[model samples]
Target: MIKLIATFCLLALFDFTNADIQADRLYELLKTKKSRNSPVSNTWSVSDEATNEYSPVYIASQDGLSELDKIVTLPGQPSGVDFNQYSGYVTVNPNAGRALFYYFVESPTDSSTKPLVLWLNGGPGCSSMIGAMAELGPFRINSDGKSLFKNDYAWSNVANMLFLESPAGVGFSYSNTTSDYDRSGDKNTADDAYIFILNWLERFPQYKTRDFYITGESYAGHYVPQLAYTILLNNKKTNQTVVNLKGIAIGNAWIDDETSQEGMYDYWWTHAVNSDATHAAILKYCDFANETSSEMCYKVTDKAWDEMGDIDIYNLYAPICLNTGLKNASGTGSINVFDPCWQYILETYLNDTVVQKALHVKPTSWDLCSGDTDARVPITASRYSINTLNLPIETAWRPWYLNKEVGGYLEAYKGLLLITVRGAGHTVPSYQPQRALTLFSSFLGGVLPPPS
Candidate 1:
């Protein structure tokens, strides 16, 4: 249904948030209307009745993650690299035979003192390995699609990075019962991730008390916040420090559909991507304030996309991968601009049997973008509304500086934080690695990026 709606608006060419935005935006408005007449829980919990009927679907168990911990040796890892890398599955639900695949990279130096950071990618079904191998991880896929190179600005340099392929049917993560995939949603995703983290900590007790943070992009605007909310709820329930959660930082976050979509159209107009007439039409016809827009809104949106052409919405200025056939092209340094073909090359590399074996990835085909291909875990917009609305206080928006220049803007609410990578698109780190690293290091240190 969400995908069907994207067809009406030119498929997010004008709005990077895509169909999930409308789904969430509409759901929130409806939920708010409903909440006016009834009560809703601040923290979501599985009822005994629901659990008793469905819980038995879990059919397996694991006591520790130690045995699952593994050392990875990529085909062309840079020589003399000092960090330890692990990739394997951590059973989140043994009875249901549910497990989440993970890739962990310790800091190259001082692994003990650095904070632990979990990174998720939002297709709601996308693999964080995309973040690991192509974005901020220690190693990047060579253009040849068969080797690796070091990422100097990798977030792992400042914190231990852990990436997961979650909700089953994503990347290599799987469940024995096919029904589990069909039942996946925001709440279950968060619930399972919370358990995954807890079980993961038990496996690596050394970092049981380490400061933790969650970060991701795109739909992760939903994932990161929901997971953080879940952790906070558990913390209150136990009245004790659970996972030592510090804060979360999301890049180009899609927190609220209405605001972000409005901003996107406004962005197109201001950036000259939309014609003056079209921009005015959008402004006049679109009612993002109420979630769903009018038919005229859809018409103008289509016109906006027609003018934008086949550009990468993720980075309006970034080049598109025109030479995908040349997967073996020589790699280049991480520059202000990204390698347009990186995604193509990454897919080729990750789908290789040799690469999959090395990473302990289940023998399944891999793609750079999931694009909600898995029906089991539909993008649940209500999760965003639920988490964001249930928060005890509103987030305070402010500027964060680095080296005397505005690094980016930020919003903080209790234990959660939202960040924008200045001039970056959907994937912040890819287009602005330095700015991303600055944002990341600051968040981990519990300080704003230093003033320019």
Candidate 2:
């Protein structure tokens, strides 16, 4: 039954019977292929100076409450925009000299009435700025990779969006304490994020009592819920209206390793991304249920990766960016077009020194994806529940309706709701913006995704 469902999801992937032995060679090449930014050197320089002269900041009001750290205006901001945007940093831990950067966009209208939504992108180390500029924010990277265009369906249309680059080392957020990056974990991350929010509220007192929500994708499956739990815990401990965290929504989230691993291998197999022999080998040698693998399993997995070819595995059916000469080339894909080359464009635009200076970011290479993937296993291994806080394999799956049709599946264990976006990859809004917005709107309304 699971195979059938995966087959339906991946009918367009590949045909296993047509696979050839050359796949082994492809797999071998993958093993040694280094990233363009391989051997990333530590960019942190020794500073005997106590103050960072490069840090750009703004404080609009008195009492030290209303301030925008590193406030910046984007280089190519679109013309005649009604919404207000502030990009800067907020120091969460002064002793550690740890500060997290953020991009906040007020709703297009009714800034005071709309809820505040915090968007996080997970690498356990990736920047949330990607989520803001590339995925669901009000502005998108232009084809030239140096300009911007407005995203019509930006989440800011419905809510005040807050995009954060967290945990001391992701993007512009940094710590004077070097070990903070090495010591970063889900618990510390959640604790810091909670503290950051409290400090952020002190800066923007208007939203002190407004409705708030947490939303993110990928490893944020751990980041979002854990932070939400912290907010809940603190709320109860204080018996006050501090956070106003109402709900959480995650897209294409990694809930559990065992289930995700099973789903991934299943996805690859049914999509014909791997040959039947390779699939069988995986089943025999790899234990997805226990998160264990044998030597033979590793070999088979390599073959599978080899067969995956030069396509974006995240969106299997999506096109690959084979052209490296993209500087002058208006990429074949754009925000609405869902072009696969968006990543390249984003990397180019964010790393620009001018853009960096505008955002008050020190000169350092910005990586789209970073951090140790291992930090996440500890997070998923523990049980988390909306009610009891235990992570369970079998959730209460129900069909959520949107536009009177089945939009996706929704499962609620106690008060926690997990909604799976239909036909979406790791990033739901990027692949299915309309559906994602529907889910977002419904989730904020305290209802299921549209039941069409």
Candidate 3:
């Protein structure tokens, strides 16, 4: 029986069929590789100085568009834009502990010292690669959810852009031990993300001192800040302060649940997305809490719809993939459940295959809308009910996600820049990557820009 298991494991480890051989390593079982893990896999012990020093980061300019374009090997159509793509893996806990799928697109400019940023999406289970292919990445998959297209305003132009598919269970990133996959939470996810960076440093070694920034949205407001705080704490303790850790930026973040839900419903009324009758009723009777509803309230879908009354603009709650047919009929197959937004990514993305090749990922098509994906996951109920008004930002964690500890799941971190793009809903990048780009650059530079 042991022999049978050993042989099966070896086959899984050796079956490397992919564009980049590096990616195959992620699937390789530690048992078969039998090799030691990345060097910086050690845990943090209370120490004054870091036990290790990362290699110096070599800065590059945002020039050489031609070179970067080639690196991605994206196709071009006169009507379509040219973009780049690459996919692989990074080891977070090298003791064969944790791993994350890595994706990047060389900036359009030839500059070697371009800035580096890691972008993540929320859902705790959603993959950021959707950012690479659907929203910020140079390419967008066709509506078929299988083909590829070009994205003209890819973020790589401004920085050495990268996206990750993390926490196992989501995307091609898998775990050797199901134990890791079985459990999911903020702390573990952040720790694993930190380890992934350490391993990423081991692999690239060159970008150690590079100005590194972390960014995300929605539930990621939590994922992004928490991860940044971990890096900040670890850097101070381990002496591996090489992470430029410049600044964290989040767009339309779910900062505080009370405010988020309030803003959500108010947003519906202010924008004429919700019925006046529903809005007034919510304001008068619904506590957003004891709303006299049987089902759980707050962000949970079913009850939220029954309570909010088509706040999504003649739409119920976030729609399931069932309405994908609507996208096709309306020529809207550009986005998917994988991404919350980016349907517009299709308008210009499909024309250029160069962006597709640069991303090194081939999907039958891309799902830009998060609404569709929400249908599949196990629906959740918020700890507190959604707020009835757009409240103020009080703490780090949203009321729904907060647990009495860690400040009700709200963490307070210094040096984070918050951005809210007007006229944008849900995922900002998919809806407004350009606006997101402006906010991102300002955050990295440690400055706030005037809102549009």
Top candidate on TM-score is: 1
Kindly report which residue stretches of model 2 are placed more than 4 angstroms away from their true locations once superposed: 1-72, 239-241, 289-292, 327-334, 372-423
**lDDT at residue 350 of model 3 (Cα atoms):** 32
Native-vs-model 3 lDDT?
0.46
**TM-scores for all candidates?**
0.78, 0.77, 0.59
The TM-score of candidate 2 is 0.77
Q: Tell me how far the alpha carbon of residue 360 in candidate 3 is from the true structure, in angstroms, after superposition.
A: 8.1
lDDT of 2 by residue, 1-452 (tens): 00000000111222111111112222232232222333323321224222323221222222453444434468877777887777777787777889888889999899999999999986557788878887798878766787787777789988999999977898888899998887776677887888788778767888889888888865676688778776766665653346877767665455555655555666666666678988888888877554244667677877876776665555555555665445565433355576456667788888999998887667888876545111111111212212235645344667766667666666554445555555554455766666677767766676555444
- Candidate closer to the true structure by TM-score (higher is better), 1 or 2: 1
Quick one: best lDDT, which candidate?
1
- How would you encode candidate 3's per-residue C-alpha lDDT over 1-452 as one tens digit per residue? 00000000000001111111111221131112222342212222335223454533222232332233234243432243443445654545445445566776667675368778888876546667656665677666655443555555567777888787777655656566776765655666777787777666655555778878787654565677677767776675664434667666554344443444454555445544346766665565434332132222222322334543322221123332323321332233333233322334342453234544554434324322211111110011111122222345433432111122111112122322222343233444554455555545555554444311
* Reference-based lDDT, each prediction: 0.64, 0.63, 0.46
Ranking by TM-score: 1, 2, 3
lDDT of 1 by residue, 281-381 (tens): 98898776663456677778779867866666555555566776745456654545567677677778888888888887679887644321101011222
